[model samples]
Target chain A: MTAVAQPEPARRRTASPLARAWAFVRRNAISVFGVLALVYLLLPIVVVIVFSFNDPAGRYNYTWEGFTTEHWTNPFGPPGLGDAMEASLKVAGLATLAATILGTLAALALVRYHFRGRGATNLLIFIPLAAPEIVLGASLLTLFLNWGVSTGFWTIVIAHIMFCISFVVVTVRARLVGFDRHLEEAAMDLGANEYVTFWKVTLPLIAPGILAGALLAFSLSIDDFVITNFNSGTTVTFPLYVWGSARLGVPPEVNVIGTMIFGVAIAIMLANVLFQWRRTPKGAQ
Target chain B: MTFFHRHRWLTPYVLLAPALAWLVLFFVVPLFWLSITSLQEGTVQVGYTFTWAWENYSNAIREYHTQFFRALLYAGIATVVALLISYPLAYWIAFRGGRWKNVLLLCIIAPFFVTYLIRTLAWQNILSDNGFVLDVLKTIGLVADDGRLLATSTAVVAGITYNFLPFMALPLYVSLEQIDRSLIEAAEDLYASSAKAFLRVTLPLSMPGVIAGTLLTFIPAAGDFINAQLLGTPNQYMIGNVIQSKFLVITDYGQAAALSVLVMAVILVLIAVYTRLLGTERLAG
Candidate 1:
C-alpha cells in the first residue's frame, strides 16, 4: 500500500531544478509549518527547563543568572510551594478516582445499553464541557455559599470533580463506542457468568480508555486554575500559589516542579506509545 | 438475585445511577442555583436575598461592558491565530507524519503537562521588556526604542494562543486524518494540480474539524482570565478578571453570578449560531 502511494520518482527526475525545488517546497510546506508549530509550543517549556537550573539574583526567576542545581536539588525549598503541590496532588488524586469510577460506569451504560433519557444524559454530559469554567466555578461557589458550606479544599475537590466527570465520560465513551461487544458475548457463551464476563473481558477491553480518562482527569485537576480560584477560599493549590506569588516574584522551585511534571508526563506517554507499538505488527504501522 | 436477573431493564439504570446523581447534584443543581443567585440582591455582609433583582444583569453589563467586549475581542483574535498556526500542523501530521504521527502529536501536548501557570510564567520571562524576544524585536526596529511585549494586549492574546493551540490542533488532525486519500488521488488523476485537489477535496472535507477546533479554542479562550491577569495589566483585563474579583475579592455574589450567567448565556448563543452557520449535520461524530 505504501509503495503504491509513493510518488513516481521518474516524473520528479524529469522536472527542472526550479520546478523541482518549488514542488519540494509546496509538498513539504505543511510539514515545515508543523515543525515550526511544535517549536512554538515547546519554546516556553524549554525556557522553564533552562530557568529551573538558574541561580536567580532576585526573588523572581525571570532573569537569567549563573546556572546552578540548587532549585532541582531542593525543589521544595521555597515556602508554600510544597504545601500547594500537596494540595494539588490531593485534589487531583481524589478527583481522578471518583471521576474515573463514575465516568466508566456512565460510559458503559451509555454505549452498551438503550435507555430512557439517554439523549438527555449525552447532552448533560456535554454542557459542562461547553460552558465556561468561570460559570462552573461561580455556580458551584454560589451553591456552597448558599448551603453555608465554607469554600476550602473540599469545595475545590467538588468543583474539580464536577468538571472532570464530563471529560472522563467523553473520553471513556469514545473508547467504548468503538468497542467490540462480541467478545463479551463470547465470554458469556463460554459459560462465564455475567460478572465474570464483565471482569474478565469487558473490563479489560475498556481499561485503556479508563486509564486515559483517569490521566486526563488528573491533569485537568492538577492544571486547573480558573475553577479552582473561584471556589477556593484560603486553600492554595499550586496554580493559586503561582498566581499569588506572581505579583511578588515566583521562585525557581516552581520551574523545577514544572520541569519534573513535564518529564514524568512524557515518560508515561512514551511508555504507552511503546506498549502500543509492541502490540501492533511492524508492517501494519 | 433472581429478581435482579429477571428485571434486565434495571441494570443500565443501576450502572448510571451514581454518575447521574453526581452530575445532577453538583452540576445541574448549581446551574439552577446560579440563576437564582444572579437574581438575588445583597452583599456578603448582609447576606443575599432572593429579591429577584433582574437589574443585576443590566448593571453588570453596564458597568463591565468594556471588559466584556475586550474578552470577546481577545478570544476571537487568539482563536484565529491558533487556527492559522494549527491547521497546517494538523494537516502535516495527518497526511505526512506516517509512523511518527503519534510521537509528533504527543510533543504538541507535552507542554500542557507542565502546568498552565508555569507555562504562562515562562512566557512572562520570554516577553519581558528586556528579554531576548523583545530585545531582538527592538534591534530589528519592529518595535520602538521603549516598546515592550509584556503587560500588553498582544502578550495576553499570545498567551491564549499558546495555551489553546493543542485544542485546535487535535480535532483538526482527527478530521484531516479521516479524509479518504482516494478522493485527492482521483482529483490528481483527472489532471488537477495538487493545490487544486487539496482546495476542492481536502479543504471542504476538513470543515467539521475547522468548526470544532474554532469552537474548542474560542470558547475557553473567551472565558480565560489567567493569561490577561498574569501577562497583561488592569487595562487589558477581560470579563473573567472582573467576574473573579467580584466573586472572590469583592464578594459581590450578585454581580458575579450575573456576569457568570451572562457569559455562559452569550457563549451558548454564539455556539448555537456558529453550529448553525457551519451546519449542525456536520457536528455529529
Candidate 2:
C-alpha cells in the first residue's frame, strides 16, 4: 500500500510464479485438449489391436485371458471368414471401378461445362448423401421386391454403387475445381486431339482425385452393413458375417482381420499423403 | 481438338448419361417406388399390393414415437459432443500445427478406416462391466459397482459419438484451415484479447463448417442402429432398430417404408430449420 502497486510489483517479482504457471496452462490448454481428443479417438482402435493378441478362454472374446499370436498367423482359420473376405473384395472391386468411372465423368461435366440442368444435377447428386441410408436401403429393397429381382451379390454391388456415386462425384469435383484450366488449354493448343488431350493431360491431372474417390468407394462398400444387410439376401459380406457372429459369439480372428485392415489402410493413406506432398510445390508446405 | 468445342451442348449430357441413368434407375426410381410401396398393403409370402394403406404411417407414429424420440435425442447429444471435442482439435490442427498438420490429421482419422462393425464391437469390450473403464470410474467413486455402462443409453450414445466423430472433425478442419490468419492479427492489433478475437472473428467464419459437420454427423447418427444393437439393451432401442426389424424380421414392408418416408421428411425439415436459423446465404456464399 506504500507504493501505488507495491503488492503487484512484489508478486510479479517473487510470488507470481504460480500465477505464471496457470497462465501457461491457460495458453496451451486447447492444444493439450486437442491431442487428448485424438487419443480418445484412437482408444477403441488400440483396444481392437490389443485384443487381437488375446487368447479368450470362452467363445466370446470379451475378457482377456492370455496372449497368443495364433489368430494373427491364421486369420482365415475361422469358418466362413474366407468366404466373407472374398465376397467383400469382389463387390468392393467391382463397385469402386464402376462408381469411379461414372462419377469421374459426372464430376468433369459438372465442373467444366455450363450446361442445362446444372443446378438440377447438383441437387440430384446431393440428395443421396442427404437422405438417411436406411431410406436408401428400404427404397431399393422395395423396388427389388416389386420388380421381383432376386437379392444377392449383384444386389449388394448395385446398392453400394448407388450410395457411393455421390461421394465419388464430390471428391473428384473438389479436385477438379482447384486445378488450373490453362494446362488443358495449352495441351489443346499444342496439336493434341480431344481424346489425346483427355488421356494425356486432363486424365493425369484428375487421376489423384479419381484414385481418392475409388479408395473411398472401396472402403464404403467393404465396410457397409446396414444397407448391405438389407440388399443382401444370403450374401455374407465381411460386415454381415461379423454381425451374425457377434449375436452368438465373436472369434479373435475378427480382431486380427480388423487390425490388418487398419494397418493396411493407414499405410495406403500415408503413401497418398506423401504423393500429394511431392506433387504440390515446395512453397505450399 | 476440343471435346467441348466440338460437341458443344451435347458433351455435358453425354458425360452425365451413365451416372444419371444409374441414379434414376436405382435411386430416384426406387424412392418413387418406396412411396408407392408405403401406401400398399404388403406381406413377404403373399406379395405386396397397391391398396392405399395410410394406416401404416398412423400406426408407425403411434407405435414407435418413443423410439423416434430416442433416436433424435441420442443423435442430437452425440452431435453436440462431437462438435465440442472436434472444435479444439480442428483449431489446433489448422493453426497451431506446423509441418505436422497432415500427419496429425491422418492419425486422427486412421482409426475410422477400420471396419465399422468391428470398431463398434470394440466399444462393447471397452465398456464391459469389469473392464478398465468401469474399474477406474468405480475407483474414483464416480460409478457404483452395480451400475454398468454396457447395455445402457450411455453406451449407445458413446458408440454414436465415436463412430461419427470423424465426420464432424474433417469438415470443421476444412473450414478452420481456410480462415485468413491476417484477420486474427488485425483483431489483436486492435487490442482484442486472444479469447475475444477467437470468439468474435474465428467462430463466425467457421459457422459454415459447423453447419455442414453437424448435419453430416446428426443425419447419419440418427439413422444408425448398429450402436444400439451392439452396445445397448432393448430399453435403448432406436427407430433404426424398429425399422430394420420391421423390414427384415417381421416383413412388414409397408410400415417400414412409411417409417422411412416419415424419417426422411422429418430430417429434411430439421435441416431446413437448422440452416435457416444459422442463415444459409452466408454458408452458400
Off by over 4 Å in 1: A1-21, B281-285
Q: Give the C-alpha miss distance for residue A176 in model 1, angstroms.
A: 1.7
Q: How well does candidate 1 score on lDDT at residue B195? A: 75
Chain A only: TM-score per candidate? 0.93, 0.89
| Top-scoring candidate (DockQ) | 1
TM-scores for the candidates: 0.96, 0.94
TM-score of 2: 0.94
Candidate 2 versus truth, CA RMSD in Å, comes to 5.3
Fraction of real interface contacts that model 2 preserves: 0.76
- Provide the overall lDDT of each model, using Cα atoms, as 2-decimal numbers: 0.89, 0.89
Candidate 2, CAPRI quality class derived from DockQ: medium
Best-fitting candidate, scored by TM-score: 1
- Scored by lDDT, model 1 comes in at 0.89
Clashing pairs in 2: none
Q: What are the per-model DockQ values?
A: 0.71, 0.55
